[model samples]
Target: MDAMAAIKQTFFQECEEQLAELEIGLLAIQDGDVNPETVNAVFRAVHSIKGGAGAFSLDDLVHFAHVFETAMDHLRAGRLAPSHEVLKTMLRAMDVLADFVRAARDGGCVDAERSQTLAKELRALDPDGSGAGSEMDDEEIAFEPVLMDQSMFDDELEAAAAPPVRLFTIRFRPKATLYAKANETALLLREIGLLGEMAIACDASALPLLSELDPEGGYLSWTIELLTTQDEAAIREVFEFVEWDCDLDIESDAASAAPDDIDLAALIQKMQATVEAELSALSPPPTRVDPLAEASRKDADASADPGVIDLAKARQKKSEQAVGEHLGPKPDQGAAGGASQPTIRVDLDRVDRLINLVGELVINQAMLAQRVMEAGLARASGVATGLDELEQLTREIQDSVMAIRAQPVKSVFQRMPRLVREVAAMTGKLVRLVTEGENTEVDKTVIERLADPLTHMIRNAIDHGLESPEARAAAGKPEEGLVHLSALHRSGRIVIEVSDDGAGINRARVKEIAASKGLIAADASLSDEEIDNLIFLPGFSTAPSISDISGRGVGMDVVRRSIQALGGRISITSRPGRGSTFTMSLPLTLAVLDGMVVTVAGQTLVVPLTAIVETLQPKIADVHGFGGGARVIAIREHFTPLIDVGRELDYRGENADPLACVALLVESEGGVRSALLVDAILGQRQVVIKSLEANYRHVPGIAAATILGDGRVALILDVDAVVASSRADSAAFEQSLATAG
Candidate 1:
């Protein structure tokens, strides 16, 4: 990439972070957070975007961000109350600001009408129309003593007193990182010039000979003479981004401030000429190259780097990409101009490559250990001991690599608030989204795939799950419906729950709808769990007519399939007239896992160790037959249902007897416990996961397949699926028993 292109890339990258902060801070204020820092943070986010937009000459972005930041300033200064009406406008304006940014980044068109509409609304927020001055959010204002001429004292008697002109001597030394951060000294100097009359002198004393000087090194500094009505606070604000990052010192230069200081005036004049001469010696920039035009220019070639504008790519890639895609910005990149964690952005392909290499190493290590075991090496033999140590090292290395791919679910969660707002607006319902555990970490791939399912779930929560305002008020609930979204790691899996405090799924109504749709027999006797499960059935719809949201009976089924595709499960729990919660349990990483190898009907299977609660040798005394064939095993006063793994998986034609089989007690995501009847238990080991869906196709009860240390492919059991199948079997058995009776 060329110099300008690279710098433009960094600007947009930083825009993503600024946009995140802007939305979060606005949300915080809207949520009634009274922290001044939060309000200031919001102001700074928009201010930074505006500053960068000007540098890249993104005129539209600069204009929109200007008005938006103006309204945010009112909140920051406590000039405007965060009333629902006011915040709603600001939030809408934030959406426009994001559109402007994405348009500028991805070379896409934005609705000029929408931009104009929002700009007018934001401007209306500040009737006084002094928003441009509000951009000094980070400036530490100090009205220091300034010299007042005797003439000014006399002028107070005859006319009005004028503001004092303060002289600031700025010593700026840019570090190499400043350039690396894509910050230009020329841009900083230009911003400084906007404050007042400024003369800059380059200090090249530290510059080495041409052969000795490093091209990337900052061997020169500048002495700036600034005289303006603005305070030192305003002057320092110009360098706020790199305050502590670079060598910067600012103070009053009183002698220079004096209008009659002829010696200093002469020195500044000479420096100004020399600086201009030096600048003119350099090559001129392109007259037509503009970041603003390049991004949104439809006429541009296809080389408009997908990395720059990914929303366009996502739109083409996933049909489920909703209105919220690329709507909200990413979280704060870090501290201003300095990354706190010293993190670097790496391409996903590189990370995936590393993950694949580690998987190969894991497989290779398992093979080596198997070879040693088969060679009859003594347990304490040097080769055996060395292999054991190597195994441990390989496991640690694999974990570290997987950790590299671990990202907070916040990335996906950030987009949902926008989705909720849009859907709620479209439905004309008052809805509030409460989120928790956004900091909970999951694999990046899982996080990315979760966007569609989560969008569908959130929409469902608002459209079907949440009652209308009138209905909620009639039900003795608050007028505003609430949709709570939370994520947490439960039992070695990431569980994201979308719940709504609306009238829960009407059981009778759901069953009637299913029956009416010919989805189930009219006289079918169903359990509560089965009724809840009916939502996942394909082509199931409760809505009387299809609108923009949720009447097509498509989302819930697609949600189930998507989760299942990720080696995960989704279950629903509802209470009539109260609420319903949809919980999705997904693996932390799809790469590798520690599993308990077991035999079922002579076929080896891998049971996730995380899923296993305990192992038990089922005693005849503890087993009780429930119906025709199903049984419950009593363990510690808890009657857990029994599922014959061999029968559920169809590996055996006949169901295995509970007492004769060892039961692997496991719990599903929803806390449903079941005893999985396996023939015998093999030892535990770490196995690398190879997706069956990728290699072949998805199996019902099997999550994925992995190669064992014995060099054989063993299916990984989907514990949740097995538990669910057991419930279905139990329901069938009870019905048959009733018929027999």
Candidate 2:
């Protein structure tokens, strides 16, 4: 990439961070957190993005962001009330602003008409044409110098009589909370320096003796002398982010003396002497590089005087400790110390490559162990012991690599609020979305694929599960519907649920739709759970008529297929007149699997351990054959289908003998228990999964393939698929027999 392209990429990356901050702040405000700092943070996010877009000459982005930022400014200054309707408009504007940014980065275009409409709405939110409104002038809107845009002021003669330069003495004392939030004093000081020529004096008089000091405590403060033509509002904007976390006072010397009349050169000398005396009286501060100066020097505008322009250069010559650099060894560390660990942004491709290499290592280690055992090496032998150690180490390495690919599900959850807003508007229903456990970590690959299915399920909940506002009111429920999304780690897997406090699934309607669509038998007897599941059948729709949101019979079935593709299972539980919840349980990672290797019809197969409820040696007496040559195994109290793996996979034409085979009791996706008959059960092992469909082609009864310890490949059983396929075949066979009879 060219230099300009690389820089542009960095800017876009920063834009993403800014956008996330903006969304978080807005959401917090929506949740009744009307903190001033939150408002400032939200304003700063939009301002920063606009500034970056200006640098790149992204006209559309800058234009949209400026309008959006203007509306937010009204809210920040308390000129605009954060009513639900206003907040709804702002959220939609935020989405459009994000779209503008992505369009700029990708060299595309957003819908101009939509952007223009939102921009007008944003503009209409401001109470006054001038940002200086009445009510918030004292508490929120500080004094800002307004410049005239008339032709007379545009002339050179009038431009020369611009705002006079004033000398300001600013005292900034940041609390420890400032540092805790990762807001550096150095950056704040640098921003101040950018406004004008400034000299800063670090006060170390409050510093305690080394033994008495708290590393994380804020003991130092700074007094700065700035000579600038900017107004007080411009200076305060520099400390906007840390305003609530620090004690900041910006005193303008404008009342006492003008910049030319004030002798800043002499004032700098006095401050320098005071700083030196304090340094001598107290223990000398730690020596460190000046991050502010380094940053200023790297800036393109570095040629202009930014700091200590009038002060003696000799004062800056000393290796003075940076005021931003506190006494702490690690200022950014979290309470538990893990947050202090420095991180770098690495390309995901590198992490994936490492994961693949670790998978190979696991396979190689297993192969070596198998070869050693085959060669008759005793388990107690030195070589065998070393192999065992190697095996453990290999597993450890694999786990560590997988950890690098694990990410919080927040990235996916953050996008749902927008979807909810858009869908709710289209459906003309008031909906409130509540999310919990967003920090649950799962494999990035799974999280990526999770978005689509989750989108479908959430939409289905609103469109099908949730009742209209009128209907809800008539049912004695609140007018607004509630959709809750949550995630958590369960049994070594991640489970996500999208629920709605609506009317729940309409079982009678669902069954009616299924029968009308010819998806199920007209007279079929099904439990409430079975009736609910009919929505998953292809071409089943409960919609009265087709619409954009749903109804071409393609929502839930696609959700099921998408979930199964990620080695996940989804189920639903609904309470009539209460709510409905769609629960999805997915693997934490797809790179490895814990399975019981079994041999069926002379071919080795692997059954996922998560699917197995229990295993037992089947007795011939317990196996009862039904019509169409199907059998069920009676276990404890209830009976489950007995599916022969050999016949299911077409490895043999006839069913395996019940007495000779082992029955592995497993649960399918729909919570149905089935006993899979296999010849013999091999020992369990953790095998590295290889995608069968990617390498070969899609198979009906297999999930993926993995290399066993003995260097042979085994097909990982898709237990749900096998059970489902067998049920279909048996149903077909029974119908054929009935017709013939």
Candidate 3:
């Protein structure tokens, strides 16, 4: 990659980060709780991106950035107050800027229509329409300060007419490890001798005695006075490698001798010109070239003159290539120049592919272990030891690969604040979102899929769940309603819970909605937990108004379906006027699951272990009908619903004596436990989850299919769906029986 390309890559990465910060800041502002520091942070992110773009001569980026930064500066300095209208416009501007940066990086021209619209919006923020003269732009926009003026140059030229012998005083301190690798300070002195006439002085005051010295350690320091035609930078370059590890100070003779004869300004300008020429020559060519060809050429030349290869240039090239491959072709130079933003864009497909490969590796390793066991390696003397080592190594590799795909849930959670703020603003409520476990790691796929569901839950919590600020204060709660979003890994599943401290779900209101929607019978008996879950039924919202924020009656059910599709379940718990909590438990990865294999009518089925509560043998007497076709199993005093696996799956065979059947007790929505009677337990194993949607339509009670260690496919059961189907069937069976009687 060339210098321009490398700089462009960094610009996009920084822009992305700035956009994220801008999003968070806007959300906070919308919530009516703007923090000055957060505003400043967002301003700085934009400023940094603009600066980087300027360095690469991306004018388009610089132009819009200048305007956006001006508006942000006004807000930061308290000249302009944050309001709903302001935030909305700023968000739209942020989106436009993101597109501009992307277009620039891809070598495509910016959309003139969109750019003008965004520029108009920014200009509107300044009533005068000038949109200029921000102090920050004047002081902070320039990379560095200009050192000398033209008058200083003219005076120096007149003084330089009389040639003068310039003397210099130099002080140098070498780091402790400077002479440890068979190279001595003598080599450095020899190199310096070639540059000028020098007087060397050694400082040995800090060197310890022979007994106290470490054989491999260096202990020496030196200083020098040189009379040379060489410039100051040349003298400084002699200690460049050890600059950070040592201290060096150089004093020009003008300070100690006749100032008129020395003419320091003339010498400095000459040195600057020479440095600029050298830098321009060393810089990469202005024209673009094929990166692959460049890489090949560099690799071939690496052997001929190893010292000549610039590591910085090589690394820069690699980073640019990586970015291009990940984010597509570079944006047009003009489009890139206008926005000072930094962002690192990565392709989602690459992340998905990486996860898929890791999943396959895990399955193959499991198969290998199974083969070793079948070969009787565990019973053999030395074979068992080797097999154990192999298993350990395989497991280590699996863990390392999985770790690469795990990303903090923060990227998803950070969007919640904005959501809460928007919902609260629309509903005329005050809500503060408190988030925990933002750093918890989950599969990138899980994180992406989780964003929508989490947004819905948060919106619901703010719009319908939380009471108005006045109502909250009257009820003894804080004036600012609190909505809590938390996520954590429990029993191999990531559990995300969204809870609020305001008005909870009204059971009567939910029941009324269910009845009006014809979802439940009029006099149906149900538990409190069951009533709370009715909100997840399709089109079962109790909101009285239809607004752009949330209440069109089409979110909760979708959230549930999305969670279930990812091999997860969603549940709710609420207390009257005490708030509600919606908890969603999702699989660690969609590609694989830790499952327990079981046999039903000679067919193997995989049940995710996370849903299994216990296993037991229930006698015929414990299984009794509960009026409908459904049966209940009495375990101690509590009666749990029972779903016959054979009947549910339409399996036909000689019925196993009911008394001898083994029950796999599983928990479903709202703590509804069910005993699934299978033929036999086939033990537990990790299996790769293969999507049914890839080849076949989704089966009602099956989440996915996986290949077992024995190489046979087993369908993974969706316990939540099974329970749901059983209840629906029971209700239908009861209605049919009543009609017949």
Error of 1 at 384 (Å): 0.8
In candidate 2, the residue pairs with backbone N, CA or C atoms under 3 Å apart (3 or more residues apart, or in different chains) clash, namely none
Candidate 1 lDDT at 279 equals: 36
Q: Which of the two, 1 or 3, has more lDDT?
A: 1
Model 3 lDDT-worst window of ten: 332-341
lDDT of 2 by residue, 488-571 (tens): 986577889999999888888888878887888887767787798888898888888899899798889999999988877788
Order of candidate numbers by TM-score, starting with the best: 2, 1, 3
Alpha-carbon runs more than 4 Å astray in model 3: 1-10, 18-44, 56-354, 362-378, 381-392, 470-477, 517-530, 541-545, 619-639, 652-658, 669-672, 727-741
Best model per lDDT: 2
Q: What is the C-alpha local distance difference test score of each model?
A: 0.81, 0.82, 0.72
What is the TM-score (0 to 1) of candidate 3? 0.64
Comparing 2 and 3 on TM-score, the stronger one: 2
Q: How far is candidate 1 from the true structure (C-alpha RMSD, Å)?
A: 15.7
* Model 3 Cα lDDT, one tens digit per residue, 418-511: 5776678788997777889988899878898998898888888888888888898889988889999998988788889999987887888788
Model 2 TM-score (2 dp): 0.82
TM-score of candidate 1 to 2 decimals: 0.77
